[model samples]
Target: MKSIKFTVILIFMMSLTTFHAQEVVVVDSTGVAQENNEVLTTSIVKDTIKVPFKRFKAEGVTAVVGDYVVLDSDIDKSYLELQQQGIGVEDITRCQLLGKLLEDKLYAHHAKQDSIVVSEAEITSQVDQQIQYMVSELGSEDKVAKYYRKDNIAELKTELYTVNRTLKLASEMQRAVIEKVEVTPEETSQFFYSIPEEDRPVFSAEVEVAQIVIEPEVNEEARQGVIERLNSIREDIVDNGSSFATKAVLYSKDGTAQKGGLIEGIQRNSPLAKEFKDQAFSLLEGEVSEPFETEFGFHILTVDKIRGQEVDVRHIILFPELSQDVIDAARAEIDDLREKIVNGEITFEEAAKKYSDETETKNNGGQLVNPVTGDTRFDLTKMDPTLSAQVYNLENGEVSKVYNDRDYTGKSKFKILTVTNKYDEHKADYAKDYEKIKALALKEKQIREIEIWQDKKIKETYVNVNEDYLDCDFSSNWIKK
Candidate 1:
């Protein structure tokens, strides 16, 4: 139990750790190229467990968790994955990796027993996205197949579907186990204090920032120019018998341009701007639509195919130009607002509510929340580089000069930021860091729930450890004999 406890704790910590996003090459013992793997996850269990099966040769079954078999190669591949993820696996033995794999298989096996259904469409969509990403990265579908050692794209997709389905099942089962678990304020306080004074987590310097953004106004001429450009593109496809994809390659501005502006499996409720979806759904097969304006830019769409409630479509986006005068006016407007706040004539939050153009943050008084942590405070060490550079030297309540920036869609905007609050590096405090502590407590509670669920499920299920792994110190008892 002590060994198993260590394994579980390590797994939990690793699950919380973020991994590097760079591409990783997976090789064999002799350094021969086997597969090109991506950093699908920085975690230990689910994402890291996705082993490229291109040239994999199984070393026979090492254990049986209900209906699922754990092959010896699974442990080997997991070790390689951890190493590639920059996790030091020297201290992490095969027995431990196997233990994790067994746990995953057990979860997946019972997910079926518990009637947790992972939709085939969802799994297929995930596979398609994965393949598409790989193709874009590796340059071609053939290259992607070769990188994975698949004979063809079809083989790669088939293998990927199996891998994705199993992962989804395991994930769903784990979610089912711990979904209801929660931590109370008392539990959070207890968890924080239970740690020895010398061992409590240290927090880095953090700041809460607020901002007001102003986008340059587009003149009628610029708007009409973009609309006319899109109309011309639509005409070329509909009238001149030109290829929409070729036109997208020659003219579109969005990231999807490389894929000929293709967007797949778009439901009516997809996160695209409402106007874009409205135009998309209105178009008949092969019928190109007139230009439509969305927040990103102007677009003209053609529905390549429609199946049920989903549409497979292609479209091109073109951003209207902002005149220098309008751009200067936007900067001047924000600059004036900043001066008023600094002179105490208007509060920053008050000005933000009345004038900021960013809808997401404006209602919150322009308070920028950390998207990752759902908190207003951002740790300096982990802050976005561009944002850190902007506010690094700011004192509490000090407003920054107007700065130029681009939104996610690359639309230019002018903004001024203020560090509303700043905290120097310090040891964790109960009241000061209540939210962080509560999150930690909740995660610990969830881990315990998963462990408890595994214990009960392992006993009821017919789990068999091969003689080779019989000596493994698994947290859950899998060796019934």
Candidate 2:
């Protein structure tokens, strides 16, 4: 996955369109106005302009918008970066890119004018999250530092802080401009009807699935053993001067272990377990805590840094390894429940609500929700790998046998999956695809609002583009020389 900074830049570039055709003008030293066909230099009075003739070699400026300036080399660098990312470098693409950068600068300029302030704590948190993501992708902090030619992850974060802040400010400004945009049902219906029949989209097969999850219960002895192991690791770090990150990578069972157990930008009021949150927030900088237990497992952590109510920390988590007997017990329990469900002794919904260990699904009577759509239905291909494989051959209203699987936290669990509903591949339907069509309409409205905002900002901001780029169509009036 691309880093957050790159993702923001891509969004800006992809959201813009070319402007309509317009006249272009160029002025020369002789005070003669001519059609814009090539680059021209305008002479300035020697006494009025301060030129660093001795200490500087000047390059041409590609664009100037108010106090913001885009050099020729900046545009060249952006084009090269796009090419590296396998994006097209056609003339229209470059024009669109230039327009996006110009608009971004205007958004930042206006944000400053409005006295919009982002806290240092927020920026630091963002930097930490981005660094964690980068470390995860590149396999290690060492690898990430090498990739960026930095001495360490801290250096990389410092380098990216300004870029991230600018992106964040621009994004906030964009949201302020369009946060009130909404599409009503009537608007959605009208937009759907406006699409020609031949141009309507087709959808793939979809399914609605649900499950009852049963996590294996670790015995007291096993739990104590995990705690003891974490205690030993903590001792090693405290007394032996051993690297916390190295120990975490070697011993931690959490998903973040690959990134040296770093959890970035965690707030005091975050959705962590109360026990875990209290323990983390109470630690002094660089102080390691004693082993503590939460729902997931035993953990020993040290606070790397703290900013106000937020913290950056590294931890080693050791989950009790479930014994074979525990696994068999969970499997047997799920199997008995399945039998009861199949024999009509109890409904699956009732079993899920009464016995399933998955809090989110149990409360919903085992109904799986699609996070992206906030619906129970999902494309078969998009379903969980373990659930989809078992449900692929099952018909609607059929239940699968108890199967061992892992949940999002990577804990082993036994589950009985049911396919509640299924739909074959079909073309878009007004009644069936109302949510999808409505989302599209909402996006279209948002784009229109953004375009209007851009046009107003373009006219208000002082902008000037080089004659070479002035000939290209642009979405904004950037040639206000």
Model 2 sits at a Cα RMSD from the real structure of 10.6
Per residue, candidate 1 scores C-alpha lDDT tens digits across 40-106 of 2222332232333344354577888787877766666666667767888646766777777777778
Least accurate 10 contiguous residues by lDDT in model 1? 24-33
Name the regions of candidate 1 deviating beyond 4 angstroms.
1-58, 114-147
Candidate 2, residues 171-261, lDDT tens digits: the string is 6787788789999999999988887888787888999888999988878988889888988998899999998999999998877788688
Per candidate, the number of residue pairs that clash is: 0, 3
TM-scores of all predicted structures: 0.85, 0.74
RMSD in Å for all candidates: 5.4, 10.6
The TM-score between candidate 1 and the true structure equals 0.85
**Per-residue lDDT value at 177 in model 2:** 82
